[model samples]
Target: MTAGTANAQRFREFKMPDVGEGLTEAEILKWYVQPGDTVTDGQVVCEVETAKAAVELPIPYDGVVHELRFGEGVTVDVGTAIISVDTDPGAGPAGAPAAAAAPEQAAAAEEEDAEPQGRQAVLVGYGAAPSSTKRRARKPQPGVPAQPEPVKAQLQAELNGRPAAVPTPAPVAPAAVPTPAPAAPVPPAARPVGAGAAGRPLAKPPVRKLAKDLGIDLSTVAPTGPDGIITRADVHAAAAPAAAAPVAPAEVPVAVAPAAAEPGIVDTAARERRVPVKGVRKATAQAMVASAFTAPHVTEFITVDVTRTMKLVQELKQDPDMAGLRVNPLLLVAKAFLVALKRHPEVNAAWDEARQEIVYKDYVNLGIAAATPRGLIVPNIKDAGGKTLPQLAAELGDLVATAREGKTSPAAMTGGTVTITNVGVFGVDTGTPILNPGESAILAFGAVKLQPWVHKGKVKARQVTTLALSFDHRLIDGELGSKLLADIAAILERPKRLITWS
Candidate 1:
């Protein structure tokens, strides 16, 4: 309805709150409201997953939700108004004061007397409702797939065209069932009549669209919809008709050399296939481009005989104390990085654009660059400089595990002063690593392998590894950069030197 047609209201915007201390940003894991959805104060409006955990954030004010800025999985900063509430926002609930009661109000009453009769407690705070709920992952059932788990349940409002009302719960029920997605795989508490046969939930418009594009059916296909919302893929599968030509099995094309072609590797496939730059991959490319072009990058390489370091890893693995721990060359390489940082603190710093200066950190928030199913996430351990060898080793293992499982939060990936890229894990000797945006330097740890080397006047096999440092030349001069690289090389040369120098 047009504002002038009947009634129009000016609504106040509810900005994303800092749910926890020092939490400046959060990813909008799911939106519970779209514009025009009614919501009550203290009701859950959306679920945001912070670095530490997923939390269900409540609505700060009551009203009809007027708009949402983006789709689910959007990362937003504190103070960014994510939803608009069109109503009397500052108004308090049913009979409470205009604002939440202040602690001083209660304290003032105590000071009056044992029986402070007739004297009213003066409340002097804004009428904002107290938030009792905390942040958490989006609500999901057991054995549910990750992709189809739309920002359903825990949302007080509905998005786009989905119905917002939920079935009222019965008092005598064994347990309350969550509201079902209309045409999703997981049926509602009780499947509705006239739904898909075999008791499957029906598909929604978008899901139907997806299925149509994929050549699927709506009624015949099994649903993979959130809250029983029919997914597009399911619809397409159902819509797709079986073909008579499919009666024959597909023959495996045996790879054979062309009769008249050259004997070398055939051009069966293109050397490279172009993929659309979208989603996380596209965003990564953009961030890299911005950093590479804007920041003056200088690449430096140092080949080190890390034979002793490799041997130490094996010894640590067999040691009783390190039995349960995950011990690998990465641990020793990480130790070498710390040693190098202590010798050269300036290398472990970033160029602060907002402050218009170089910010040198006393503690190392060591970021270990990890490639995960979600994308590349560099979750770092804060104050890594102070942690002991064993503590750091355990922390690294936990960080890698969390990242690989698609559970690494944004907090884990931010506030990194320096980054260590383990290109060696990919079996590559070395490549000029890209600096993690704000950070001035990034170190690349390459593979360790036996190579012929001249040591003690004899040509013998030694565990050789290459160290590559990529720095922002605009911040780190060539001489300082070279010295930093050399210090890392020197530490790897003599492991005992770290005991003294570090």
Candidate 2:
């Protein structure tokens, strides 16, 4: 049989998988493939931004692209189909089979416990599908006229990027009804773009929320986003003039009406700019809040002279054995901290609230806090306690570089036993840092500056810096915390303690 007459085309729907632990949804940043484009298994079709990080999603099956369920910048929930593929395109038209098998049916098939017959291995876990809830429909209010069919057609045309034909109304006899006054014409700038049948403007959920919170009508806000979608910036720009307008006195009667007070208009006193919290920033904020509230924190500070450590850093930079390695104060600081942790094994632990136990760790997964354009992320090196100084420095370099590039994986940010945040890079002296959730402690490395010191009973200039260690009060008390901090400081001051202690 010829390929065209073999069988009807079969379609497969690719659902949005849960890329990270407990991630509900992700926003499609961009689509690399379009409809009719051929795609292979494991080929990345789009990039999505989740609460934790930006991740690229790969299509699991080979086929010609049939449809994109959602557009760019649209947030889709896990287990929801994002794209469709024509799996058996050689059979020509999908015809009756594709029509018979609706998206709902495909979703229903995926709900089974065991994998479906043709199911392919997903890159990440396919999360549980969201439960469907049915709601009662509201009846139309009395005295409200039904919308015209032609106007509804026009709205749909606008959504599809098509020019709609103007419909001519039939003439009525003069005696049938009294003549009504002509309605005011809407300004072109004030007109909504790509409106739905219900007259609601096209915008993302976040943008809609921002407009709602700022008391701005989305219809009045010009859409600058792709496909005539209203953006956050557009909403803010619409509210700007109203926000800048001068307020009138309560006693004074004004003839001209304010821009705000008009029906279906934007009105707000929002002086400060509002940014929607999402992606990395949103996750960081939530984690910090949980850590602060759940874990009782106690911060301890100590100032130390690190002249010898600084000199050793310069010496290591020139050494052949440590050649091509990142030899900085942070490198030394991390090594010293690791050595201190080795001496105080009890400090490298986590408080398991669920188990109601203080779990001590045999090895450390040291997390390094790196600040990026997206937000702050802490990507730790696995089994940091077992690595050599050169290996540690290499890992640190890679981790920081990856984090700054916004390519750090969610896996790298988990299983951290201890953390070190280098506030010194920002010229900060010290800070009471919050512990990373699940980790017992976080050490803040302060700026190293030259100051007058009594070296061998003589007044001389020496390198000085301060260190702050914040720990879980429940697991580590003042005595244990102080000893841990003191050990780290001693290693830095002598620079020989690393050799002796190790």
lDDT of 2 by residue, 83-179 (tens): 8898877867543223346544432221112334544312111122111543454554443433346876675455334477656554543654555
- lDDT at residue 397 of model 2 (Cα atoms): 91
Best by TM-score: 2
lDDT agreement of model 1 with the native: 0.66
Local lDDT at 416 for model 1 = 83
Q: Find the 10 residues in a row with the least total lDDT in model 2.
A: 121-130
Give each model's whole-structure lDDT: 0.66, 0.77
lDDT of 2: 0.77
Per-residue lDDT of candidate 1, residues 216-334 (tens digit)? 45555654443233443344334333321222333445566556756666755433344443334554676689889888999999899998877788898888877678899788778
Q: Would you estimate the TM-scores of all the predictions?
A: 0.52, 0.68
Q: lDDT: which candidate is best?
A: 2
